[model samples]
Target: MFAIFLFVPARADAAFCKTGETVTLEGEIIIPPVIDGGEWFWPGKFAKRPCQVTTLRGKGTLPKECAVGKRMSLTGRVLDAGIVTLEVASIRCY
Candidate 1:
């Protein structure tokens, strides 16, 4: 007899990019369950994670039409899976 198995894993933190560094990522903006659970971010595909930059300085200027999984280019510092990208130099929808 043969058996099939399925595997699922818990969310993992993203690669940490130190402050003052630049990172360019393509993902969607999402609300987080971290840091009081009202955060924002540019999420990743596997974990649906963000880099933890939702409440940063340049956030207000970003056009939020990319919130619904449209690929957007976020260039800035890398934070974490629950949030990402800060000091955003540019945001463009693709």
Candidate 2:
């Protein structure tokens, strides 16, 4: 009886993404323009851009290449429906 239940699929199963897959997302990476450590940046050349990936927590997505204000295409491994983990992630700025 317990074995039967174990194999049964839930009537309503909601999951973000079921598999770990890699996909290339093209967008400008941007940093929020707000005070983090009691400081705000002026919107100018120095300020970050929309398509820039400044800092990456994990591997691949290189900060040196994906700097502020660059329209880039990045490949990421999907961790969830709206979340993705970078694995050997690379970017191309356009």
Candidate models: Cα lDDT each: 0.48, 0.39
**What TM-score number comes out for model 2?**
0.38
lDDT tens digits, residue span 1-94, model 1: 9999887667565654555566665554454212223334332442222333443323444464644556566666544445543655666765
lDDT of 2 by residue, 1-94 (tens): 3554356655432223223655454545465333346332222222122222222223322445554577656554545333323322555655
Instruction: Please tell me which predicted candidate would have the highest TM-score against the true structure.
Output: 1
Native-to-model Cα distance after best TM-score fit, residue 48 in candidate 1, in Å: 8.4
- Pick the lDDT winner: 1
Local error of candidate 2 at residue 79 (angstroms): 2.1
- In candidate 1, stretches whose alpha carbon ends up further than 4 angstroms from where it belongs are 1-11, 31-60, 77-85
Clashes of each: 6, 4
RMSD of each: 7.6, 13.2
